[model samples]
Target: MGQEINQTQFNEQAFKEYNRRLLNEAELLQTQLTKRCFSDIGEICGYELEFWLIDHNYFPSPINQAFLTRLNNPLVVPELSCFNAELNGVPLPLRGDVLTAISKELSQNWLQCQEAAHGMDSVLMMIGILPTVRQKDLCLSNMSDLKRYRALNEQVVTQRVGRPLRIRIQGRENLDINHPDVMMEAAATSFQIHLQSAQRDAVRYFNASIIAAGPLLAAAGNSPFLFDTDLWDETRVPLFEQSVEIVDEANLENHRVSFGQGYARESLFECFAHNIATHPVLLPMLMDTSPQQFEHLRLHNGTIWRWIRPLIGFDHDGTPHLRIEQRVLPSGPTIVDMMANATLYFGLVRFLAGLDDAPESRLSFDQARNNFYAAAREGLRAQMVWWNDSVTDAKTLFMEEILPMARQGLKDLKIDKADIDHYLGVIEMRVQSGQTGAVWQRAYREKHQADNLQLVAAYLEKQRSGAPVYEWEI
Candidate 1:
């Protein structure tokens, strides 16, 4: 989806050519894996954080084409909406001082982005959902000027036979609405964490990531309001799911954006095989690249928006590697807060995947999927069935069990002691005080009886303070 397409419309011949290349690439990947041909890149980490561009009044600003040009940073680019932009971190090895190095680099890049936004009398805000966004702001006119995005919108609507997209979210309040295009997906942004695992442990690491989703999201929930109506702690989950739903005659998968069916039993190859077998081609952009590049297979894989996605990438030497992309966390309350979320994720998953026994064996997949939705809806207040099959509140489970495992995981990774203490301390305080971004937003609205404008005004002020969400005053 990052790459631009040459044409928006495709013919039957285009689909046939694309599928032919996809099959050849899938077979080549299988042969390479059977021969153990992939190079082992020990645990490496990266991030893709999405942010909103708001004007002086804190409303959405549609100027990213100009904003990105003025900014002129390759690492930062336009997102689905002109009001949104994404920042990508350079891949770093997960070892001593890596966490601190990530923090310093992010701070530096963010300073440059802020300067560019300031020049245009606009600023950037990183949150799951901006509370002040109106329904009018999500039209096709606001979409970024990219052919791939335009083609994606056309393909999704075509799959639905021209019926308008329906979105019905049930939270503290019921949100039943209809949208004309796929731009409603632009309303929800995320802080996606990526880890390039060793080829031998890819399956275990991928399953461990699925099992860790509930605890991590419960602690990092930041999106509680949409269009001034109170919704789930992270309303982005359902909003993104229903925004671009494709109704196919053969329902191989229920929805494109979901928690997945089951854990990986043999290998991650099954995921790519399933992608080839189940999904119809959305973007049939037949490429003229060699089979080794896997261009057609990759472009097809990009269209499926699984919550935890498997990515295929090449290293500096052109060796293919398997990466686990965790897409469940929201963008932010602060840069440190976002990095702290990364810390917990890397550490806990390392511990879980490296265990002598499999954690997924003790916990069923059904409970894992159920726990995810429960955490999203209730935040720290939700009760989850943990590894021991005990249904406990997410807050207590974190403080007593999950946090300690994460601390041990970081120590095992050989991270600096200072980095562990500072980052984990932020998360510890957050869980202990019960003040995730969602919790703070709900408290502010209840106490002041304020409108959405006032809420956003106060949020921007505190966001500028560089204080963690747990430290914000209601």
Candidate 2:
């Protein structure tokens, strides 16, 4: 059982005490983790993609009850909402052309989810944010009936009292959004990829991922608009940060949480220390006195902060493994598209870990952060600055530089050639066509101005019909 902390109860004394405890706990965890063998190069690799659920009528359904009653597979897991379900693929070793294996598994999982959705008249769609997710729908009433979900929601909102969250974005157009509850966070859905490597290489991989994130995200943009408004290239970027931000004047003066602090050091422990130091735990777990408590520590770490999360799991013989799970990507319109993103990432990690780039001081962390923001703001249309001395459009970078390097990297790893070509080719085609999920959604939102406010139903219908974005009939 986890103890849920209320933000309102946090005073200066409590804040100091909490930080003090977190620092001590982190030190102990670090000492224990350091003594164990954590792989420095890539060994284990995996992904987790989440989707929003809809019924035949293209409306948000309370049909999770029916779907769960029929779902029996171990892989089809429950999410925070009855209207959402998650599909976790098998973990593959980061060896011998994993692209084909990952693609086959992801496609199979999607197919399984589709099959489970059939009898219940539900469908799964991958968009940055569901177009029709209404403000009213974000209430506690609409939340999934799970203790964890409710506990998290209560903890976040209670910390802020009844004040609506403050959200502002500057893009092609400026927008301000205010929501009284945390339900607005539910509007966002994403396909997050997790790459497992040893603690030593964590910083290099994490920073390299940040550098490539802008172009990769722009090229793979699946979310262009939200609530029928042409906002950021991937609106979910801002939407997610805003929805989860729990700011009180007192807490703001003491502690704060944002997308990231900046670039990372050469070790994963730096990130763990940062999280433990900066962010206070919202949910608390009761201390269980058991010899198996070490196992529980790993599980709790997984459930903490979404960005740059610390992951600890065991291997076949119960050997504890430590890795960082990245939680800042949107789910995709195609499996190949997802694989393309993964390939570039894995390549960058391998490339960076082996090469010693100048420290975070020389490479502007602000530039990296801005680059990702630029991508979210402009999609493929954005101009990006490379880490090396060159400036190029995101599409050009992906088609010529990034994609080929990704292929080479995958090849070096002996990943299946067919899988590499197929997935990388999808990314190439997406760049040439300029029709990422976000591009299509933006076009549709523009063409259907009259139906803009229909948000959920309209978008759900278009997505469920399995039609191309251009060919979609609203």
Candidate 3:
């Protein structure tokens, strides 16, 4: 006799058991990570950025999946959405001024992707959400033919059953919209920033950085206006969170779908532990085989969380490495602008790590979370409550305090001055002119108010070729 089972059994008991096991696994992994620490924090680090590709006309192009399939390049990979693509750049070992090297490598990789995409009539542009993305475009047909994407989507929709994903965000005006499917997640595009780290301190530092910096970054108006509404500047922040949210409408008191429970007391282990505790695994493996020996199809159940997800993977030598995947940022007007954002974040992490006090202790986690929301609503106009309970404008804080600190931090690393200025200068001018990518986008929309979302996106595409974003005439 052979053992057999139903392929689609939703065993509540089995689900509960899996959650229990995952919590235990998270604990074990956290312990293992604590045992492995790097001596030089700055010595080893790298990053990955994902963005959607549009045509010369600035509409979502189907070329991304085709390009990846045809090119079959490791540096370039298929993303969840067909219009999406991931750019994997070489890691820069922490040393004197690795910024220049990063810039060069990014430029080369971007150009290579462009060259590959030329035949398909596609070009890459980054924004929080593609303005042209429509309700019709959000269908499953637009999703890339990848296992991870399919698995995740299946888990989310199944978990939701027939209930719609309801989003009620109060911006300049309240937004009360509901999508019958999880396809709304497609509207949330991002400029993902990767930061390499060792196991021991990775989770803690990553959590702290997110708590401290997330709000300020979002407030910079890096992304404003989604679907032609002057909603949250980084509307992706809210849109993504709600798009895949899982909830049981009948059980109102025991609502499962909610924003993060709280801030981490110590490390990323706490965040992971919280995730394990609060949400049931939308995906789980029942593998009867081994890696390099057998295939496994793990059920990647959806979660109602994750602004920044901690990932574990293997290097060429099969050495396990950990990295923080920043998922809240918007894509850019230029690569230089994107790199500037990266340098600010990279410098802040290093600077904070060297400090005596943890940012979490000084700033309430709730306040930090609040800051992010405020920034999204107000952009540079956001007022941050700093020390002495003083309310300083975001532009003042970034220009007077954070920018100088970032400069010193980068200088201490002996980063090439040329790279530092080239990037930071972009940041500086952006702040000085009040012209973030979001602001530029909003302005473009206003100029072409008669045009629909697709036409507005087309206008932005036309504008990208001539001058840098900071230099673009409004």
Best by the TM-score measure: 1
TM values, all candidates: 0.98, 0.85, 0.85
Separately for all candidates shown, the number of backbone clashes (residues 3 or more apart, or on different chains) is 0, 11, 13
Candidate 2 regions exceeding 4 Å error are 1-24, 33-36, 39-41, 248-257, 289-307, 356-362, 447-474
Candidate 3 TM-score over all chains jointly: 0.85
Candidate 3 — what's its lDDT? 0.63
- lDDT at residue 33 of model 1 (Cα atoms): 77
In model 1, residue pairs whose N, Cα or C atoms come closer than 3 Å (at least 3 residues apart or on different chains), thus clashing, are none
TM-score of 2: 0.85
Encode model 3's per-residue lDDT on 1-474: one tens digit a residue.
Answer: 001222434467766655555655565656655766222242355665677777766677866667987667778776667887777767677556677778788788877777777768876766667777766777788877765556566777787886778876767656777777767776766566667666555745575566646533643455555555567777777777677777654542223333355655555556565555456666554444333211111122124335556555445565556666665667665677777887777666666655667666666766666676677677777887654455688888778777787777677667778877777777788788887766777776677664544444553554456245667655
- Candidate 2 structure quality by residue, lDDT tens digits, 1-474: 122223323346654554455555566666765664554445578877877777665556655656766877667666666677677767788777666778788877777777878867777777677666656666667776666666666667777786778767666567687877666667777776677666666666676666666766777667655655567878887877677677654553223334466676545566666655555566454333332334334433433544445566556665556655656668766555567777767765565455555434445776776778778778888888775546888878777677776777677667777776766666677778888777776666667753644544565566555444434443
Candidate 3: where is the Cα deviation over 4 Å?
Answer: 1-24, 34-43, 55-57, 198-204, 215-220, 248-261, 287-305, 314-321, 448-450, 453-463
Candidate 1 contains a number of clashing pairs equal to 0
Count of backbone collisions in candidate 2: 11
